[model samples]
Target: MLSPRESATRERVSLDGLWRFALDPEGRGRSERWWTDELPGDVEVPVPASFNAVLPGRESHDHIGDVWYQRVVRVPRGWDGERIVLRLDAATHRAVVWVSDTQVAEHEGGYTPFEADISEQVRAGEPVRVTVVVNTELHWDSIPPGFVQELEDGRLLQQYFQDFFNYAGLNRSVWLYVTPRTHVDDVTVATTGIDGDTGTIDYRVAVAGDGGHPVRVVVRDAGGAEVARADGAEGTVRIEGVQPWRPGAGYLYTLEVAVLGADGEVVDVYPQPFGVRTVAVDGTRFLINGEPFYFTGFGKHEDFPVHGRGFDPAAMVHDFHLLRWIGANSFRTSHYPYDEAFLDYADRHGVVVMDETAAVGLNLDTGAGVLNQAGPMETYSDSTIDARTQETHRQAIRELIARDKNHPCVVLWSIANEPDTVSPAARPYFEPLVAETRRLDPTRPVAFANFLKATPDLDVISDLFDVLLLNRYYGWYVQTGDLVAAERLLEGELREWAERGKPIVMTEYGADTQPGLHSMLREPWSEEFQIDLLAMYHRVFDRIDAVVGEHIWNFADFATRAGISRVDGNKKGIFTRDRRPKSSAQALRQRWHGTEEPQPDTTRNVQQDPQQDLQGDVPQGVQQPARQA
Candidate 1:
């Protein structure tokens, strides 16, 4: 959705290194055409990784189905009347591209960015080739829906849909760019309305040919002057004393849309980088520009330790410098949608995101331990591929609210993660995915991610979210360590989600520590039972108050898929997975940035030093509770 930039005086071309990979697993590269040339025994491989964890065996990263990359390019001469494209920054569950054999484009949701234009199959001076052909395979109408098995000496494995580690190849980065054939295309921006000291913003552009020019938006502020300026293409700019983009205190504003012409010059700009601010929610508080914002970090995972989910910009600025050294602010890409340089470093280092959507494993009659309140409850799948998986989950929630409704650290949009909202077939698949996400971007707040079988007398879909992202696990997966029965089942599920008045975000509570696991009394995969399950889910999110926020289910520790309840992965990561830390990251830097907490080890024995129980991190015939704490 309009996010393949490079027009600051256009002209791109950085097809990011190696190519010519292979695989096809007998799909035989479009039945032996292989994009009409080259790629016979393919090899090189590396444009943005995951080629099965940067190769080292298994025919270069466990062969799935349909693969084959290629590459050759050339064109550049004078681009021959403009408009090139080919972008591709990711190519997971499906792609098609081809240039020499002509195909054009075929994409089908693979984490985002996709383009093709290629101006009538290139050849301005030679080489061309291209070819792509991905296809990591997913099913029941895919949107994260997966499960491909097949063994018996034939090998094909992939089981399990969500919880990370599927890492297919061509994970990101691949350009060619060069626009201007009557360019501009799209550029939303929203903030609209701030008051007290003036704010607004609004703007919207989308030029691509059709009667020449007249766009012009421009707003600049982080010191490059320009203040406010508008000419058409869509109004409102406002400005005044408005700096607001605060979380850890951060600000940014510098639009510059343009299109001008008719002798006004600047024929195609499109700079976009907004952040005027406004995240509203009101009822049970979660405002932003209106204040009340509380959402301490993690539900994350684009995962790493070998570029599994690829795109590591120095591990994305060290996970936003360890979520501002554990004081946290917000995070929740969990279940999908990440990388656009991690929302441009949460729009210049402020934080707060949410933005989900790989609509995770949409239930489908649950399998294995799938939300087993002892199974037989699993629902969601009304057939016809669940109506083509709810139309690819409403086109991945309108492409994650059109590629993250103009950032300001994307407040919230979620969609589905931990779905099967306690079936009646999940209210016709989440009532049209919450009416196609409030008809795509009703400006922030649209939540989802509520597992723990959405209780409260068997869920009513958390009264259709505006916020109530509960992914509860009570002392870890249902009273596993039994902190007084996980605080009376989280005070009866936070008083039934604070009596449904909204705002409740405890999106996934943690408990999976293995980094130097220890236990004198604190058991379950101890790093002291993941620091006593985040100080008992932060003392029940500080005694309700509509339980505002918590996050913690992962800030680090990723790479899941060696089973036996994940040992080499999904160690609920409060760091470790190479990001280190994990003594519950020093008890969340002492319950979020107040620091100095780690003490209790005065030679062990809080109740007879014996490694309490729940040996392999309970959850599945759940037992282990020698009762200690």
Candidate 2:
């Protein structure tokens, strides 16, 4: 076993360690003390994941846009000319980093990692303060317009109406790193084409501060046997004649890129683990390692109950175990990007990930009109703002791709989910965005979640992307009352796409059911209904060609403001947001992964008994919806 010190040395600092302060740009955080000092007092705001769940008074503070966070940390000693950097693993919307009151970097987009090298600004030996201000305010140019607080009838109303908790604040880890000046800035290794008999490996290494040194790349199999090695200036290499990475038979390799000085001593190095696996979507078919593979996973949001996005490493490991134990091989990073820790774990574990952009479907402009209030065939235009909106959309995509493109686990790049068709601005934003992603990473496919009734605008640009994904809540969103109707709708759509020779991924499925809740008649919200719905979806998928995968709408019940009965929102998760496994979660695991079946007692629905259930019921905090629509 490795000693803690050795483990710590090898383990990258949790991106969550940096200083955090909550204040407005005008100076709300400058005060030495805050108003409330409760255990999780006014100053002790809950991180977004469990924030609202804990702070009832602050529930009204949840909005779409920015809030401010400032934290101070003592500089670690024994450092010389090392980079004193600040990294936010995942921050919603926009982030600005500062060290000792000096601004170093500004990044947009909430999902990917953003860094600022504060080496020159910080004092070498003295303790220095690093502060980060994350603006969750609305900018049409930014994704997910920031927070808005509405007032109604002598009460304050803040609506963060989304599928998941707007777990803002520094949800992912924050960290500081000390690195050699001349180092391998980045290393990208891709398993481009994999066949039973032949395979290809391509890599790109970004080297900086090497003092005119040449970089060397070494490819090693799992046993540390050198498979291929080469030299390059900017750090690029290709390896052929390799065994392809395949699931159920974990085949992986390591690429070690070393930067050498003129005298040949190693100046800096970067090591990345990768698999030479060929993945493609052929006319609605997903081929991995030359085998037709089906996507059996859930749409996962990167938030937890206790820590929000500040995930404990054990929590991540626990999550992987749960996913495997339950029989899932894929997951969609629904709505935003996730921490690198999650991605790295996925890579080693062989889970297929449909890595998503920070963009979402709510960008649709309802013209202040409720969706149901609109007439049939109403002017279905993208409600998003014009050209400026497109630019922000582009930036979000670029940042996400640039940061995470190399991960073998990430097979698909989802551009946006359900950009509103009611606004004319939607298609213009999507088309060029898809084209640009293709230009950057042609090895992977680009797709968007078709949330609306209409065909997505970018579908015609099929040549640019490898797969077509549709987020259908047919059983929940469109035909909740009729399982047959849901099956028909799903089957019909898959058949149409198959005929077009377009590979399709049922990106979203599953119904919202309060755990343990059973219909006296085993109706829609019952455990039986949930199980039947999933099986029916599988049935529909079985009949279609090119239907490679099916992801249920949600992996767990997240934050929903509706405060409906036991489920605050729809309560569709297989596991509660708190990580409690639900009956449906077990049913899916049993059916798909051949996992053990849960006892009848374990499948008791939560909706009927909120206290006994895994605390999935609506708390008294959020105001109940006035007359469910």
Candidate 3:
């Protein structure tokens, strides 16, 4: 793993542009020996994007086999004698890389960055051919797992157990970086504690090529003033008068880890920005730096049109702006880990993130495959929690923790989203994963998104977490449009969770609101209904002090497989897929952003009209009812 950016000591060249692409659906590319050179059909496609959504034809959009990408990169002359590495930011599912005739690297996970050492493979100032084979197919062992259904007509359909489109490609950037022989391999920084005027930071560094190399660590405050310095790989640095990072006041300290070679020259440097804050679970409260903290945001997806889950900075910026506009302060990367720069922005902007793994919908055959599954899916088969999938999930979590442990924005580590938690088999599957996370990093709280179901006897895995994340859909999916009963059921469940003596966060709660659709009768799929339902859930959330946060089901509408239940994808987003505000945004602004407290009748069935009372701010596309026509 490397820093998100490059410096003089650790230099990198971006290989993010058009690349030669070829589809190998027949899986003959390996047998035909396409690894040595380019494949036959010559089609140039953009790097940092999924070939699925950019190309024409339904075949390319749903191609689910070995896809090849070829690009020629020139080794920089300045990188001579240095440890040259080729890094793929992200490739879906699995990827194998070959530098010309030499097979360099193979990585299994898709959401994290992986690199291959190519120091001896290429000559300085010469061009080298790089080939990447990405497998987009899914199986029982895959996280956010899915299966392909062979129809009776010989037509294959990709059906994901998860609710998002299966966007596959080198959907993130590629880079060729150069570092000294003995580099700063790994950096782990943990916030120990914060007393009145001093804050403690515990940090460690792993040098790559050589051991016993002198390591130096330095920390600079937000104003670029050096506050503390320390030596040794594992030691603590105490900064006097340290400022704690809080919501809307994201104070970050830059920690630089540097290694020195035998010549006493700086070989490599890794800079990481961290916040000085501690998170702990006490009694029934989730505390951030020793005070009760509440999380109010959305369970978001890195999805949109054209790019199809590809990393788009402009879109991400717009989404963050809209989130701030809607009075949201946090979000959970539901189902998968997002790009690195996303968390960097979250750290800068003070948005707390429940950093979740890509291990979603692991419960096979059951409708739990779908988010907020819309049926009776009580029977949790053993196949869902098999040994192979468990091991894969464990690896994903380790990589996630190792990658994101430094971010102050990440206050909670969510192991999975909407998994089969109610089954008897889930206990053995989830217990070890949560235990391992706590073992790996005890700084943050560990929790998983739990679906509302199963009896107390069947659902027995709630004790493993530092907090409780309940994904209940009382108004939207339970009663199908009734917020009143949804309120009662939501309250009762919150009561049960409060009895556990742990903080409860409503991780998933929202209604589907079509962007242009509006209704006066408060019907389903209307913006008003979305606002009404959220208001009800927020009422119960405010009443119960044990409830610490409420992350709405989604921040924006995202692409999903074509199904009867999903209307052009799940419409539960408070904002449209294009980042336009729904009525819920205006309502949430009043409830969260405008005032410290919003006064409303939580027990009332009908909500107040936004046209008159919402401080002259009307919901997007809301229409005033006609006067007696």
- Top-TM-score structure, candidate number: 3
What would the TM-scores of all predictions be? 0.37, 0.82, 0.91
lDDT of 3 by residue, 244-302 (tens): 88766678999988897778778788887899988888988887778777777789988
* Deviating ranges (above 4 Å) for candidate 2: 1-20, 23-56, 59-71, 146-161, 195-199, 234-243, 362-383, 421-425, 455-464, 563-567, 594-629
As a TM-score, model 1 comes out at 0.37
Model 1: per-residue Cα lDDT over 403-484, one tens digit each? 7788888888888887767666677668778877887677777888877876767876667668888788887777688788
Q: Name the Cα RMSD for model 1.
A: 21.5
- For each candidate, the alpha-carbon lDDT, in order, equals 0.75, 0.62, 0.81
Best by lDDT: 3
lDDT of 2 at 615: 19
Alpha-carbon runs more than 4 Å astray in model 3:
365-384, 454-457, 596-629
Per-residue lDDT, model 1, residue 18, is 85
Best-to-worst lDDT order? 3, 1, 2
As a whole number from 0 to 100, the lDDT of residue 358 in candidate 1 is 88
Better of 1 and 2 by lDDT: 1
Q: In order, what is each prediction's RMSD in angstroms?
A: 21.5, 8.5, 6.8
